[model samples]
Target: MSRAPGQFTVVAPGRVNLIGEHTDYNDGFVLPQAIERGLRIAVCRRPGSRALLASDRGGPPLDIDLGAPLLAGRTDWGRYVAGVVAGFQRLGWTIPGFEARITADLPSGGGLSSSAALEVGIATVVETLAGQALDPVAKALLCQHAEHEFAGVPCGIMDQFAVTLARRDHALFIDCRSREVAHVPLGTEVAVLVIDSGVKHALGDGGYAARRRDCETAARLLGRKALRDVSSIEWPSLEHRLREQEGRRARHVITENDRVLAFKAAAEAGDWPAAGRLMRASHASLRDDFEVSCRELDLICDAVGRLDGVFGCRMTGGGFGGCAVALVDGPRASSIEALARTACAAALGHAPEVFLTTGVPGARVE
Candidate 1:
């Protein structure tokens, strides 16, 4: 396709939760980094108040009426784009009609926040056309709201925040409740290996919402505003008061929050082993307590964790099969990947997509 006269591109990175899982919605802490793989959107203004959207992923072009009400029964990807447009309208920003073509290396439903990358990338496109930049936090929140209101997912601030505000060569330490952020350097000693298990997770399934509901019920039962209010020291005494499932949900959030802080400390001190241990523990909590892991995720984590040069391995993302992340010694990364591929292929009949990635800057116009 020929470029429009004033066309520009926006790039947004997908993120991997290095440790904390499912704790974001509980108003807890999370440590995540934006990975180098993500979406690229080439966009330019059009003549009228309608938006035309297309993707290299092969779908009919989505033409959205900017002035019309959001259709309840639009296609999944279309809903995401329209959601962002609705968000911009809600903010009183006058968005012009535009044509955007999205191409991405990020794997959708692999728990790398491809959906957030798309939303943020489109929002950035709108922001660029509007001739003003929003505060980073507000930009992230706007995308988050799009997910909640349009995508119908009750996600926490972590994914959008990391995708919008992440710095290169750093992990974002986010206090989901306060919206405070700290950039922790991911030094040169360790490498982050992300393994796609080939199992896609659709959070729109009731599994995700069910877990969130359990956490809320647990908090109400414990007389706390949210699980974040319940300290680690206080959890044991309160654990027995709730039913088995609710208690487990609450336990995961409380302990995961603690692990996020400890992992931050380990990262700051350049302690890869300590950070790896925390990653393993976080995966266990998500698997046993949060009940989000599937056999593919468990098998991959177990196989990778047993390998040499791998500091730690665990299932990442919203679970039920997406990806696993490992912290490995930088020098042994290639060997580790080879061994992991052989082992996983032997067991699963096919090798997974395993690659090394580092922290990269968040969404921006190019």
Candidate 2:
């Protein structure tokens, strides 16, 4: 096959959340694994000053005007890609224009960090074309900036950090406030079965942003910085302090934080039963209080909850619609997947796409 001269191959990994829902923005702990599903970006020099960006989904390259601010909002999904270019430039990461193509196995809107995988893939390719190497944290921050500042999603660092820096065969425990990284071993003996609800969720849909606002308001009601700053021991006094609007929000946060901590310990100790229970509890809190999970997500959770080999299961993304995570025994993995698919079809009248992938590394240019 004839190849373009200056083509740099880039690989960016996706992520799986083992525990911690809506906890990253709270500056709390999130444990996520970098799964095998990811995006690949290929870049080569283009003769003209203008850059061309394309994806394997069979579309023309998005020609971004380099001289323009690049900060302007975009209606198309291409903005996520262009936004990375803007982030690199703003942060003074030397970069050059190049023709690019992206291909992915990661399912979009599956809540599996598909967007982060794309951003990292693009950023890695862009930097490689510019002959600039970035540290892991720098790579994460740039991708995050692309989503938040450019793509206009108020997401936290879990997806980016998990994709950019997570260790193979492990989950990363992130202290969002301090930005501390901890690599916890995820035993390969267990399997992570990701079942898609096939429900599409926009981050801003179903008042997701409004829920975030409520969280902040709840924090302020108790005189804390964010939900992460609050503790379970102090919930009584804080709960009394908050009225209807704030009390429920504060209650979810306090208990959710506790669940995250316990889930982390359970995962570390290889206590699959405890972890599974925590997953159920977290889903309940998000459903009843946080108002994130929907019918499909709840259905999957309930279906998985009844299975024997299923250790833990819960919705994995921004909610209102998306996929859920289930921990299953290696031996019964297939059976669990089959039953989950059957249940999903029966519950929602549609089969779903599911992935059981191994944990991999961050993006790299080859």
Which candidate tops TM-score? Answer: 1
Tens digits of lDDT, candidate 1, 171-195: 9999999999999998878889999
Model 2 lDDT per residue over 1-366, tens place: 556678767889888788887888877888888888788777778665567877876555698865556774786767887788888777666556677777888777888888888888877776677777788898888888888876678888889998888778888888889999888877855788888888778884536677778888888776789988788887776677777866776677678778877877887898888988898888888888788888989988887768778888899877877789988887778877888777767777778787677678778765
- Clash totals for all models, in order? 0, 0
Question: Which of the numbered candidates is closest to the native, going by highest lDDT?
Answer: 1
TM-score of 1: 0.97
TM-scores of the candidates in the order shown: 0.97, 0.93
**lDDT of candidates 1 onward, in order:** 0.90, 0.80
Q: How much is the lDDT of residue 289 in candidate 1? A: 91
Residue 254's lDDT within candidate 2 is: 72
After superposition, the stretches of candidate 2 with alpha carbons farther than 4 Å from their true spots are: 1-5, 58-60
